[model samples]
Target: MKIKLSRIDDRLIHGQVATVWAKEAGAGRIIVVSQEVSEDDIRKTLVKQAAPPGIKVNIVDPEKAVKVYNNAKYADETVFYLFTNPMEVVTMIEAGIPIQSINIGGMQFKTGRTQVTKAVSVDETEVAAFRKLAEMGVELDLRVVATDPKGDFEGKLKEAGL
Candidate 1:
């Protein structure tokens, strides 16, 4: 399978994603790689409904994603992967998925998380996961939208002293 874009956005299929990023990626399919969301029937339905017209959306757990990604049956499909956090990306890469880079879209602020950017927030565990991905040579491209200039995720991490 060809991966067009792998983005980390907690909101999953929203305005920016359903309209902008999917079109920008030129992907025929958008797969939401999240164990939590995949298991929730409501979320799966909602994500599917929110997908852009003429595009397909699949919500699969990380394990299923690995299998689906490596399957020869899907070799012709161009996919855009969406995730809620960095650790999910790490899981895929560690499972031999060969993800070269990931777009950091939005990681909304929560209690106990420090703001890394206007749209991104992270805690200790998230910081370590991001560091691990960097160590593994995965480029962390920070951009809120396709038109927005890419921000330096590494520099943001450093600035936050993460």
Candidate 2:
């Protein structure tokens, strides 16, 4: 598969992702699949700037991303997919994108979200989507960076009484 790593991080293309995860995944391109970020010109530029030199960044909505993923054009490229939320990942999977594993990098705590970890948080809707992903046999690996010990994301959610 072209998707080397599928990660969910609120700070989409930040230092840790651009430097650490990208290097670990050996990805040639970083695809940020979020309609919100794709529409924001300033955010798009910022995310592009965060990418390491020589690496391409594509900020596109989920639908477009899935189409690109299914197309043969990027068959030779290694991609690290980034999403700010679980719903997007669910949408892609439901649309027939094959994602075997997902890394839960960061999800900042918002008003209605419950803290799952210092770097991860989720609300009811997110919890439901995550459960669905788990049910579909997608392994949810939780870790802040490549060096950190990976945690079983679904197990944590269950322990948190989701």
Candidate 3:
């Protein structure tokens, strides 16, 4: 799958993700993978309404995302995959989904989440999951804005005392 972007943004589907992100990335479709959004009929409808004027928003459960990931035939599709939390990716990886690179973008400010940089934060469990993902050959990165590129999350974790 030619995943344009894989992001961990807590809100899952928002305006920036719908319009600004889609336009800037030139993505044809967006897939927001989450356990909560996929199962909620109301939320799914609302997100679809909020999507960009032309592009499609595919709201799918993590399990179903596995199928989509495996079956997608669009080599240059420029589709994006997003999850509400980093742990969701961890869960998916443990379930045997293959992920390429991911960016930590919009997790909320929380206590004990030591700021590794402006965009990424971590405590203990997240660190463990990240480590496990790294062991599995999944590349992780941190980036704040569209213009700015990403940095290695493993190095950031080291600086954050992980």
**Native-vs-model 1 lDDT?**
0.94
Cα RMSD to the true fold for all candidates: 0.8, 1.2, 2.9
Q: Where does candidate 1 stray beyond 4 Å?
A: none
Candidate 2 per-residue C-alpha lDDT over 1-162 given as tens digits, one digit per residue, 9 for 90 to 100: 478999999899888987889898888888999999999999999999888888889999999998898888778989989999989999999999999899999999989888888899999999999889989999889999998898978778877777
Flag clash pairs in model 2: none
Q: What lDDT score belongs to each candidate, Candidate 1 first?
A: 0.94, 0.90, 0.76
Give lDDT: candidate 2, residue 148.
89
Instruction: Give the candidate order by descending lDDT.
Output: 1, 2, 3
TM-score of each: 0.97, 0.95, 0.78
Best by TM-score: 1
Instruction: Give lDDT: candidate 2, residue 154.
Output: 72
Summarize candidate 3's per-residue lDDT along 13-91 as a digit string, tens digits. 6766775666665777888889888889998898788787778789998888877767747555667788877777887
| lDDT per residue (tens digit) for residues 91-160 in model 1 | 9999999889899999999999999999999999989999999999999999999888889898998899
Poorly placed runs, candidate 2 (over 4 Å): none
Alpha-carbon lDDT of model 3: 0.76
**Rank order by TM-score, top first?**
1, 2, 3
Q: How many clashes in candidate 2?
A: 0
Give lDDT for model 2: 0.90
lDDT of 3 at 131: 82
What number of clashing residue pairs does each candidate have, in the order they appear? 0, 0, 0
